[model samples]
Target: MLEEIAIEDLGVIRSARVPLSAGLTVITGETGAGKTMVLTGLGLLMGGKADPGGIRPGAERAVVEGRIDLTRHPEVVGRVDDAGGSVDDDGSVVVVRTVAAGRSRAHLGGRGVPQGVLAEVADELVTVHGQSDQLRLRTPAKQREALDRFAGSEHAEVLSAYRAAWTERAGLRAEIDDLTSRAAERAREAELLRLGLAEVERIDPQPGEDAELTALTSRLGNAEELRQAAQRAHDAVVGLDMETEGSAVHALEQARRSLEAVAEADPALGEQAGRLAEATYLVNDVATELSGYVADLQADPAALETAHQRLAELGTLTRSYGDTVDEVLRWASDAGLRLLDLDDGDDRVTAMRDRVVELDDRLAELATRVTAGRRAASDRLAEAVTAELSGLAMSGARLEVEVRGTEPGPSGADQVAFLLEPHPGAPARPLGKGASGGELSRVMLAVEVALATAGDEPVLPTFVFDEVDAGVGGRAAVEVGRRLAQLARRTQVVVVTHLAQVAAFADAHLVVTKATGGDDVTVTGVQQVAEDDRVRELARMLSGQEDSATARQHALELLESSAVGR
Candidate 1:
């Protein structure tokens, strides 16, 4: 619901704050006092197209700000948050739109956002009905939407199922088309994969095999040097080709023997003798192991040549397939799976075709159910709207909700439209054919009331009527007022009206008055009026003179009647 609107340099409204609340709030003024500017300001808040030309003369920019309640609108809150804006803890959001030169900017909760974001959130937060909407209600598509909304969740359930089936069918058809069109391309892909797999199979790469081969080749290439080194170590440790006296083990053994001779006269000497024995055994063990290594090590030219040849072959595989053998092997594994799928494209296409047929049958069944539901709801909606029209002073009126079969879309296979006959012997025709502007207004109002009562609860948070009572007058105007007040019981209502009867039902009344400055600049302001001021405003609406005592008495009676209606 719109809590308040602050408009600056917009049209005749130089700077004005229009406070709104959760009830019927009406804006009224003389013909040129800028009543429509209030709705224009609201349009800006809702992210409507902004014309910089509408800015007040000599003003550099026009700004419109609105405070809206979001307690019943989490989706709107989520959208604002997604746009990097904050909603107040008390469930209110501030939206501001600024128009300067040839461009406009939108801000939500102190954060700049795209105007599109505000428009998207506005859909769930408010519904603005103007004279244009009365014409729109005659169109088949809009009437269908109204019927669906009035049908509530049951028709929605069937429509959802039908659309889901239709989407599945479309997906299957698209896949089939793609498969047929790209059959040759897919075959070429399969052939390429097959060739790559065959090369991989012949090479038979293994994980870490290249690294293992490299180590073996290095050892085989240096076989002679390795053997010479092992023999020299053996000679140093024991007495092979050289003397063991230069070896570390031999030196330690010599020291241990000297210590043992001295310790023989004491207990510590026995421990030193054991240490010399262990050192001699360790030196003998090392010499034996080195001698074995030298015996096993051989420089075989044939084996070395074979290792080099194998490395060259593996190198070819590595360069073409991967930097390493393991990566090449992984590629082969994934390619094999893809190759299987590519080879089975024909079978997959056939499966998809069969599934499409299945979904078509399902969608047809749901469409039939949807049509039935709409036909049943059409009768109920027409009856409710006709009953509402009777109270609006069109006593003999009848609303016919015509449901015709059409090609199925997301909404199902029905085209719904409203046809009205004002009285007996009148041919039932679409809106604007036989209905006047005032009749259209009443019809729309009746439909809104019927729609509101049709649902378990009101859906839109606020409803704005921009001169919807365009051609209505007298009791019909009073009925319009009563209906608006009735709607306000469910949600917030903002009306731009000229009728004192319609204005009488408003819980809050704002009158727009223009003040011309000495500099010849005309500025407009909106002020909430009460008691004597409200009576005067209503009197001005009833008659050209705001101070006429007869008009004031009539205004008083209208207010009294509106209170009694509540």
Candidate 2:
């Protein structure tokens, strides 16, 4: 709901604050009093195209600021928050639009934002109907949305199911396309993997095998040198050659005997003799192991050749797959898993194809149900709106809602068009094709009133009608006012009208007056009137004179009649 609009330097409205309220608020004024400026200000707040030509002469800029209540619109609040804006403590937001030179700037909740952000937030909060404005249901998509909303929650559930299935089917089709397009590439990849796996399996490389082979090859290459060294050491330790005087074991025995002979003369000598005896035993053990080493030392050429052959084979496997046997084994393991997936490509595609078929069938069923629901809603909506048109002085006019089959999409497989028949014997035509401005306004009002009572909550919080009472008078004007009031019962409504009958039905009435200053400057101002003041304004709207007793009486009667109707 809009609480207030403060406009500055816009057209003839130099500076004016228009206070609005719930229910229907009507603005009435003379021909050149600048009543349209109120809606122009509103249009700026709604992110409509800014017109520099509309700016007041000698003024630097034009500004339009609005205070909107967001208590019932959490989605709009979220959008403002996302745009780095905040809501007021009273659950309201301030939107300001400033037009200067040739550019315009928009501010929301005290934060500067792009003009498009204002439009996005306003789309959810307000709906405007005017002479040249496009109807909300003008587009086929919007018509479909309105029909679906009228179709109720059960149909919405069916739509949700259809969308889910459609999304899944699209995904499966993409996967199938990818698999089909890449079939040859995958086949070649699989062949390469198979060849690599065969090579690895043939070699049967094990962890640490490369290091083991390296050690064996080193031992086999230097066997003769190792044997000679061991034989010379054995001769030195055990006196195996007589030319070696006093081997290590013989020398230790001589020392032990000398120490024992002296032990009887000195006790310290006995301890030394015990140490020599331990040394002689250690030397004898070493000499025995050395003799065994010399006996085992021999070079085998055949064994050496076999170790080289195995090492060469393992080296070949490492150079291609990895730097070592363990790394090669890891690579082979990963390749084996990849090969399995590549081998199953055909089977996987077939499975996904079958799933897509199932989804197609499911979507077709849901689309049919959705189309049926829309057709049913179209009939009821047409009947309700046509009845409203009769009350608005189009007794012979009828509304036709045609639901035609089209290609299936996320919405459905239907195209909904709202056609109008002006009177009897006239062909039904699309809205705006043949209808005059006044007829279109009345039709739009009827449609809105019908939609308000169509068992779905109103989509917007406020509805504004400019010149809705055009070309209407007498009981027909009264009916238009009543219908607007009816719509206001469910949402806030603001109308700019000239008809006294329409003005009488407003919950709040504002009169725009133009004043000429001593400097010869004409300025417009808005003032809310009530009681006798409102009656005088309505009288002025009824006739050209507010002081005429007859006009005042008629205005009073119109007010009374509207009250009773409400």
Candidate 3:
């Protein structure tokens, strides 16, 4: 329910603060007095589009604020609580919107919120019915939805069943389409797998063979250089002395003997001579080992060639894997597993085909069930809507619902249509062709009433009807007023109407009047009327004369009679 509306610098409403209450409240004014601006303010608070033109001339911005009560609306409360906001014990939710020439912003519970989020939350709180509501009856989808609500739980159950079935069918069909479209591609992939596997098999690569071959190649490639260096080193350490006619070991032996003869004369020289003799014996042993090394030093060319050929074979692996033999060997092991799977392609295809067949059968069965459920739901919906038309003063009118099977969609395969007949013996046609504006409004009202009954959210504690009485008066106007009051018992209702009959039913009456100060055109004030004032106001509405006693008496009787209706 809207608790209050505050408007600033918006058209004729320069600054208006209006307090609202529960039950039927009326706002009455002369033409151009800016009653529509009140509704416009509410629309802005509901996140409707804005225009800078709505801002008063010379004003930089316009601001509108709506304070609403949300006692029974826990969904909204939960959202606010999640965002670390608290609703007062009185359960009031404040929504404010401001429009500047440059931009607009929305505030919820004193926190800034995106306009789109504001709009979504507003939809949960209010449903505004205006002159355009009558035109909505012309749409087939709206009519079908109205009938479904009237049909109650049985129809809803059928719809649920139908939707479930339709979903399964749609999923199966989509999968089949995707798989069939890719069949040729899969076939090509299978052939490529076979060729790649065959090529890898022909290589017959051995793991770790590259490491052994690398070591052999190193030794063989430098064999000549290694042997020559070894021979030269041996000749330096133990080769024969050419001038002495004997090896180095024999010359050292003769020098040690001459020093031994002088050592007996000098004790220190004798010890040195003994050390030289031991060194000479050790040198002879080393020379004998050198001779054996020379005999084994020759290089083999055939062995070098063999090592080069093995290195070339290992090079083939480097191109496929990393630039090394270890990596290629690992790749071959992985490729073998892939080849095994490709070899079993026929078995895989058979399994996939069987699964597809099972899914297709399930989809067909579901489609049939969906079609049947939709038809039943359609019949029940038509019956309920036709019953409601009688109470809306369209006794002769008939409503028909046509439900037909369609291709599967996200919603289901049920396509619904609504048709109507305005008078007895008239053939039923689509709503747009059959009902006049007046009839359409009543039909829409009836539909709204029914749908509101079935709605899950608490009915807004207040309703504001803007000129819904257009093209209607007399008995029809009184009926509209009576219905508005009836809705008021469950929720507060505010209406702006030109008809006196409608005004007579308001629990509180407010008259909006304009005043002019200098060149300023302003909607100056709203006055709450008392009983005596209400009688005079109703009299003036009835005959434009508060002075007429007869008109006043008639107004009293109208009020009394309306009380009885209540």
Q: Rate the local accuracy (lDDT) of all candidates.
A: 0.85, 0.90, 0.69
Give the poorly placed runs of model 1, Cα more than 4 Å off: 81-86, 109-114, 132-139, 222-300, 315-317, 390-398, 419-439, 530-536, 543-553
Give lDDT tens digits, candidate 2, residues 1-566: 99999999999989999999999999999999999999999989988999999898879999999999999999999999999999999999999999998799999999999999998988898888888776777888887887887778888899889889988998999989998999999999999999999999999988999999898888879988888887778778778642345787777777788989989999898999899899877877777787787777678889889989999999988999999999999999999999999999999999999999898899999999999999998999999899999989899999999999999987878999999999999999998779887888899899888878777574565888987878878999999999999999999999999999998999999999999855577899999999999989988988889989999999999999999999
Q: Candidate 2 — number of clashing residue pairs?
A: 0
Estimated TM-score for each candidate: 0.82, 0.74, 0.60
- The reply for model 3, stretches above 4 Å from the true place, is 21-23, 71-92, 111-114, 132-139, 164-399, 424-429, 432-439, 452-464, 489-492, 507-510, 527-530, 546-548
Report the C-alpha displacement of residue 326, candidate 1, in angstroms: 2.2
TM-score: model 2 vs. ground truth? 0.74
User: Between candidates 1 and 3, which one is better according to lDDT?
Assistant: 1
Q: Model 3 clash pairs?
A: none
Lowest summed lDDT window (length 10), candidate 1: 129-138
Clashes of each: 1, 0, 0
| Cα distance off (Å), candidate 1, residue 42 | 1.4
Q: Which of the predicted structures, 1 or 2, would earn the higher TM-score when compared with the native?
A: 1
**Candidate 1 all-Cα RMSD:** 5.1
Q: Judging by TM-score, tell me the better candidate of 1 and 3.
A: 1
For model 1, residues 1-566, the per-residue Cα lDDT tens digits are 88999999999888999999888999998888888888888888887888999999989999999999898888888888899999998999999999999799999999998888888887777777765542436578778888888888877888888888888888888888998999999999989888888888887767898898899888889999899998878877765332357676667777777887777588777887887788778877887889999999888889888878877877887887789999888888898999888888899999998898888788889989988888999999999989888777788999998999988786787878789999988889986577765677678778877887776785555888776687668988898899999988888888889999999999999999999966588889999999999999999999979999999999999999999997
Model 3 lDDT vs. the true structure?
A: 0.69
User: How would you encode candidate 3's per-residue C-alpha lDDT over 420-485 as one tens digit per residue?
Assistant: 777788887876565555666555555555455553433453456776676776776777777777
What are the clashing pairs of model 1? Answer: 263-269
